[model samples]
Target: MLNVLSILIGLLSLVIVIPAQIPFLGIANWIALPFIVVGLVIGQLSSSNGGRNLCLVIFAVAVVRLMLGGGVI
Candidate 1:
């Protein structure tokens, strides 16, 4: 429940232009990892491994998006 919410919030948190930003190899994007960890923790606390996987999947998608942008943002 909370994990899903966090994932949703993280996804909708901002609409930064990925192509417009590129510095230090997109290191700033790592900042998002914390949100992913939060989602992971919330999922773990709910005793739902499925939720954990769901968060991880979300994390993977985000990472892929950053990479597709040529690193991070």
Candidate 2:
């Protein structure tokens, strides 16, 4: 259940970021970071491979966002 919640939170973060304006990129990613962290922790705790995969995806998105200069102020 926690794994699912984590995935959902990560997905919600993606949804939140998708339509963000350039000026709001930093704020959007900052908001998303907690979701990503939670997802990763859940993934580590869960034995399911799918949960781990979702966490990987969340990490990838975070990396991309950072690379795009979105998550840093």
Maximum-lDDT candidate? 2
**Which pairs clash in model 1?**
26-72
lDDT of 2 at 6: 65
Say which candidate scores most in TM-score: 2
Looking at candidate 1, what is the lDDT of residue 3? 57
TM-score for each of the candidates: 0.49, 0.68
For model 1, give the 10-residue run with minimal summed lDDT: 12-21
RMSD to the hidden true structure, all candidates: 4.7, 2.6
| Overall lDDT per candidate, in order of appearance | 0.58, 0.67
Cα deviation in Å at residue 47, candidate 2? 1.5
Once fitted onto the true fold, the runs of candidate 2 whose alpha carbons sit more than 4 angstroms away are: 20-24, 70-73
lDDT of 2 at 31: 72
Write model 2 residue lDDT over 1-73, tens digit each, in one string: 7667767766776776665436545567667767777777887777665666776776676667666773573
